[model samples]
Target: MPEPITQTEYWNGDVGARWAAMQAELDQVFAPLTAALLDGAGLRPGERVLDIGCGCGETALLAAARTGPGGTVTAVDVSRPMLERARARPAGGSPIAWIEADAQTHPFAPEHDVALSRFGVMFFEESRTAFANVRRALRPGGRLVVLCWRALAENAWVHVPRDAVLTVLPEPAPSPPGGPGPFRFADGEALVDLLGQAGFTGAAVAPIDHPVAIGADAEAAARFAATVGPIAGLLREIEDPALRERALAAMRQAMPAERPVRLGAACWLATAVHPG
Candidate 1:
């Protein structure tokens, strides 16, 4: 069998392309969560910021606006497609450097006032080492703020459709323990402990729950769920077109009747301080 694909390869492949194409829609769906993360970050004008896993540059652009023209933003991601999409967008705030590099090992200048991620951070192959690298990039007492999914069960926007699809396909094998995946840090205590291990201080996590519209209708919602997020990952492995269609149908049938199907999203707003 071929060697397993690395996270860099995974994101740079078709997954990245899909995300690049759906950037606007994904941003709209997660707008509330983005707001919560930015508010929690408390970015100030002229504060240099490091945006980790800055896919399509939504958080980075918004952060730039908050920090204004005097500030600078280093937005890093492994996916070239997403970075290209981000670079193509209209930017009106601080200067942003959209670098197609892995944040886990990037040699970021040690001058940022804050490090931020929106649904990033969780994909690190070495979670502790990655955060430690981020910590090293921050100045004394610099803050790290991120939004990560809380748990599969807690996130109805994912699990509801996931369960629906699973009815048609077998459950995929569980990810390796403490492995890199969306819900890797679902346990708040475990996440805080990892931050402490990475030499961060005063680590804290708070739940930020909100209703996110997945699509305009059941069909749209089904397509949205099957085209992106965790469910998309699951469907990507299936080679049989007929079976895949069945799974999509299940997802459509599972959606609520609301004109714009909305589902609850649960996430943790984790924050930490870098020791000088």
Candidate 2:
């Protein structure tokens, strides 16, 4: 089957390239959330783990460490560019298998003891089907842990830059409520219900708050804001180069002068179990 059209284009094109180039910086920005996700997974030695949306393999490497030499990690993602970067990194003796495939339709063995993701599970066009497939990949009673953004309003790192960009370009229409996107699963009750429908039991979603460091200073942060993620996506739509620079300048003005520009962000640390 073919990949999801929208994501296949975005991730394989500019978005994927930008992420690959900024992998280290992005990883550092989200490091605390990664640590929380790994801690919540409670992985033990000798367990088989599946890391969905494993960009650049950071979480997969961490999982491999927690699972020890006897365990294994299969890291899957849809972007070839991201997977290329992931494969380029040294494994440091950790057992990991990197696969480029969409989690929604990929053929997965029902052999994994745990499945986890960090800010990676949200982009599914059909989340219910995607999560059901994830459940199918796990052994009986295997666990699922995912971290997802809470809401656009709750994530200053995103909304602030996004707003600044809008000052110079047309604002894109908002995604439908509960639709596929970063904040699609923001509501805890909605997520729990969706997981229940996808054959997961004991579903729970917990709120996690953290201050994310976007860059070392306002200028750096503004540059990153204009060149990455949602803000960048918006900027890309503008045909005028001057307008794009205007957006960048607006972002710079909006950002604080303090070093290591930090923004308050919130996400849901969700977990569920496959029934035996």
Best by lDDT: 1
Highest TM-score model number: 1
133-171, model 1: which lDDT tens digit per residue?
A: 999999999999999999899999999999999999999
**Candidate 2 ranges with C-alpha deviation above 4 Å:** 1-4
Question: Which lDDT values do the candidates have, in the order given?
Answer: 0.94, 0.88
lDDT of 1 at 101: 88
Give TM per candidate.
0.98, 0.95
Clash-forming residue pairs, model 2: 216-260
- What would you estimate as the lDDT of candidate 1? 0.94
- List pairs with backbone clashes in candidate 1: none
Worst 10 residues of 2 by lDDT: 2-11
- Give the C-alpha miss distance for residue 166 in model 1, angstroms: 1.2
